[model samples]
Target: MVQTARVLTIGEFSRLTHLSVRTLRRYHEADLLEPAVVDQATGYRYYGVDQIPVAQVIHRLRELDVPLSDVQRILRTPDPGIRAALVAEHLQRLEGVLDRTRAAVVSLRRLLEPDPAPIHVELRSEPARTVAAVEAVVGSGDVEAWFAGAMAELEAAVGDAVTGPPGGTYDNALFEQERGHALVYLPATAPPRVGRVHPVTLPAAELAVTTHVGEHDGVEITYGALGTWVVQNAMSVAGPVREVYLVGPRDAREPAAWRTEIGWPVFRLT
Candidate 1:
């Protein structure tokens, strides 16, 4: 076949593709990409202009840390939608990593504060009541997704019957062992049983309460501070910790305006 597209030597191809000459040789060895033509006498490699786009695509995929096998599959796939879907899956994973990194940065900043603002706490006795709820054994990593789904179901089930702000009790094992029962609900007079939503009786208990402001990512910091205070004081945790959403995403657009009350059931230590 006659060569129609302009051909460039290995050095020129490297410049156009922005790929190192040595890396191009490795791609050839891996069967990822091959030069359009090679000199029989001198063993020199030549690439066609059309291959520049292919090389660029490979470069981009490598930059994203996409596995070599996936990149090869992407390039070989004929369907545009399938190729896009494969890339989207990797992007979703990257987004999860970014979210965790942002949370870590927030935590580190809070921890490194020289003179952090004191966490305010209060002691209160709560009355027992039956509330509309959704309960599940949830993994710590899956809590966010589970909470969103369960809350949607709970809201749909109770609707106008809601009597108080939404709240949840998280058992120690959920955080300590990464999986345990989690109960989320809102106070209601007579909550109907729907799907996973049901009436759960909340037992009355003494609590050490503190409010966590802003987003929930940093709520763990407040938990640490509150736990420290509990140990220093004359109290010990007696049961699952409760969180009452006073002002949240449902009520406001700004995370800065959100308020969550964290209550740890406790009893005075001798």
Candidate 2:
């Protein structure tokens, strides 16, 4: 009875916008998309035909999982450019989340396989050598960003010419306790000391090394395999873990082509 030539009842608006009546009521309560008319005596709601587009926009924003506050900002913004920028910002966040999700799924699939393939490892004697490096005590969550920044500083200080692949040395606590001292270094003889970048003497050790192919996200599996191998071989860890970048992101565009060598400094157990 409330439906008229100039307005639509709740059911009519729901059909047009493809939103449920309950959802419309909730939106109304939220003051996101209030009905244009409300029957005072019956408490029935009616929306103007002009609100169809706005209702549709709200539905689309919700579909993208846009937060209510952001949706409000996007809907209320007068400038189309600003509106687009807000939506674009949310989309970028979604992409980061999707990338992490895909990486996790890939790792999980490999882990779930019935017959996991064995990894090959080699033993090497690494000598003490001073190299250009940055050292910091960082959290596991901040390691990636810290490494990127440190490497950039290293590149700036050391220049493009390098004798060998750059590497990271992570102490046991960094993995075991999730926060500890970590070092990233690029091989350069007589490398300059500037800012956080300085020369570090890498101590000599026997290392059980294994190369992890593809992206670093799933490289944890390789580490697990290497640990298993070391245990089977009666070798106990003697020092910090070292990750030598054989063919890393700087060397290859495709993650599939990247190779990282993980080394565990070890000692034989009786």
Candidate 3:
């Protein structure tokens, strides 16, 4: 007679795997892990003792927050290289989520902490300059990607003509309603007409300016501080806000070294 494999009931298998019965049932439903057999008369699930390793692998992957679908794919693939690739891809996604969370925590800490010392606000008159710029009505959700692409285009268009740090003008509606017209520009001796970058003259203005030294995640506080200073000093916001990227990602790889100048066009109320 041939030797027979030991068949364990679902409950026993769950205990051996250290996984709950409910989870085992879910894994079966997801087709991630399946038992070896079922009782024809009782319609009960049973697992071969040989399947213990498979159950443990499924449990470990689930613990790592891998989606059920990916887990299924990982398990179904017999090739070790494919399985490792699937796991590595999910780990990369987790790393991105962690990075965003860490940035958010830094911003939240700045918001919850006691107000810092007053930021120095200065008055300066800017002269009109020719620029290669990209203008669009952009939504808040797409602003970062849009700005990056626009800057890239401006860089490609102007080449050696770019004279100063890149800057942008953001309409109030972009903040108030989450969508509005905006312009990302590079100062140039003469504007280059290429791609979406076009010749435009950025007008001269008197601005109440303040520098934000670090990541832009907490720059809202700088804006609020600057706005308060403008109101307290009897200055009125006269036009769209300007942001000068003095030491941006292109200039410095570290966020700590980035310097952004926020310029609020202002006028003395007559």
Candidate 4:
């Protein structure tokens, strides 16, 4: 008699793949992956020893948090180059998310640390100027990519008039929700059309502004401090917040040389 290959049941496959039975079932139901065999009467699933490698790959990809659709796409492609490209794209996205997370963490750390000098808030009027800008509704996860693209567009349009730093305007509700609209721009004498540009009239108002020196990673601390000052001085926010980039990353690659102004429009409490 000829010897046959061995097949493992779902429980055995789960142990071999280090994946929970529940997860395996989900993968099967999603048609993302299927067992090597299924019993006709008992309705039990079994996997061949040869299926172990595929299961491991699927398990690792899922661990990396790749979307089910992408995983299916990747597995369906037999071309190694195509599969590699898909994985690389996901990795780049993950890195961007990690960078934003690090920025938030740094901001939180600065907020918790002791400050020797009291945060100063000054009221000032800003002049209206043309700006090359890109506006979009972006979530925290998508902000990095949006910033990169917006900055590139601004640079291409400004050629030489981008004297000051790049900055942005944020709506008040952005912090509370997953989606927020941001208008990122480079200050220019005359607005130039790039990817997306529009003539916007920024109204003159009394603004409580504070300068943040160094990387923008911890700049949220400055915003928080400024907000605290506003409340303590009996003032209420009246409009959207504006960030004036006094020194841009393009001007100086050094994070220490970067200067940002966080401005919040406010009205005195009656």
Candidate 5:
């Protein structure tokens, strides 16, 4: 008769793996890890000693910030080459996220610890311009992918007119409904429509604008600060927010050098 492997209960397995019961439960829900046996009476989970390797792999992948869907795909792949390729792709994504996070931390630190020089809010008039743009209704979760595609389209369309950097505008309804419209554009003489192309005219407006130097993802915090400034200074918003990307990913510049202008149009209190 063949002998079965020893099975450990959830608590026992958690101790062995140094993972919390809650984390193990979440892994089980995500289908990233599963137990070897389950009790029929109480539905308690039991894990085989042999399953530790799989659990460790899942833990490491998650520590690397691999998306759950990608983790499932990587685990399901049987070929060594394919698995390596999948891991490489995930590593690239992780690096990008880490870079963005580091930039945000630096920016936040600067904001919290400012120099003696006072931060000035400037009111400026912006001129309207035609741009080659891609518009999409995107949620916060899906904005990264949508932005990648939109930026790729903008770079391709920009020939001689790439003089100024690219930027985007977000409508207010998006954050409220989890569905927001984003228009990524480059200044252009004529709109190009190879694919996912649209023409948008940014209207002239008087805006209270402040420059932020760091990752675009963390610009929301800066916006909050700016909004507070507007309200305290007796100003009400009049139009959608504009984010002008003075420097971008395509420029191959340092992360600290990336500049974004957060512009909020406003009207003074009566």
Candidate 6:
């Protein structure tokens, strides 16, 4: 009689892997992972010692919340680079979810806090200025990325000739209805013809202005307060809203130090 390599039973494998027997069975049922051997008569499952690493990898990916289908693809792929790219893509998605979660927390905190701060608004007569701008119609979900990219292009086009802070004009539909036309501009002395950056004169207007400090996650609070002030003072909105990035991301590394000036085109009643 010849002695053979000892195969661990499902119970032993479960203990060694620190995974519940039920989960291992579920994985087997899903075809994501299967036992090394199964007793035909008893229907008992066993795993080879060599499969420990495979089980561990599956556990690690599950801990990261990778989708089952993606995990299956990752495990089935023989190319190391492809596996790494798959993991990286999932991590990138997780990062985006984290960003949205943080923003949601900020908005919720603003809503729950008592004694909303007073909004100080000023009337300013803005003069028309020449700007290198990019215009697009975008959904609210894509505004942040679009604004950042447009601003980058405008900044690159205006390089060294930027005369004033960066600003954006947003149609009312953007805030009220979630989709609209948007324009991001950099005031500069340069002429048009830099990529999508084109020369345009921002129209002069009487604006009700207020400054928002910190990241835009909670900037909606400032906008609401300003809107209330405008209505209470008998002012009617005349046109699209303007946002001036005074101490923006381009100037400061910390979001808390960023300053944005919000200007609503308004007509004051006598």
Top candidate by TM-score: 2
Superior by TM-score: candidate 3 or candidate 4: 3
Q: Is candidate 1 or candidate 5 better by lDDT?
A: 1
What is the lDDT of every predicted structure here? 0.92, 0.93, 0.89, 0.82, 0.81, 0.89
* Colliding pairs, model 4: none
Candidate 5 or 1, higher TM-score = 1
Clashes of each: 0, 0, 0, 0, 1, 0
Compose the digit string of candidate 5's lDDT tens values, residues 1-270: 222357888999999888889999888888878778777667788888988888888889988888889889999999989999999988887788787888678667756875523446888889888888889888978888898888887787777766577888888777667788878888876777767877778889889999876667767767877888899889998877888888766564676687898888988896
Best by lDDT: 2
Residue-by-residue lDDT tens digits, candidate 6, 239-269: 9999998997768899889999999999978
lDDT of 2: 0.93
Model 2 per-residue lDDT tens digits across residues 13-75:
999999999999999898899999999889999999899999999999999999988999999
Comparing 4 and 5 by lDDT, which wins?
4
Ten contiguous residues with the weakest lDDT in model 4: 1-10
Compose the digit string of candidate 1's lDDT tens values, residues 1-270.
Answer: 434257888899999899999999989888999989977767778899899999999999999889999999999999999999999998898887787888789888999999889999999999998999999999999999999999999999999988989999999999899999899998887988988899999999899999999889889999999999899997999999999999999999998899999999999997
TM-score of each: 0.85, 0.89, 0.83, 0.72, 0.68, 0.88
| Candidate 4 per-residue C-alpha lDDT over 1-270 given as tens digits, one digit per residue, 9 for 90 to 100 | 212257888899899889889988999999987877777767788888888888888888888889999999999999999999999999998997797798788777766678636877789877776667888888976776788887787777787976577778888767778678888887778877655765456667788999998887777778778999999999999887899888867678887898899999999996
Runs in model 3 with CA error above 4 Å?
1-9, 12-18, 48-66, 73-92
> Per-residue CA lDDT of candidate 3, range 1-270, in tens?
222257888899999999999998887887777878866667678888889998998888888899888888998899999999999999998997787788789877877878667799999999888788999999988998899899888898899988988999999999999999999999888888887989888899999999998888778889999999999999999888999999987788999999999999999985
lDDT score for candidate 3 against the true structure: 0.89
How are the candidates ranked when ordered by lDDT, highest leading?
2, 1, 6, 3, 4, 5
Residue 117 of candidate 2: its Cα lDDT? Answer: 92
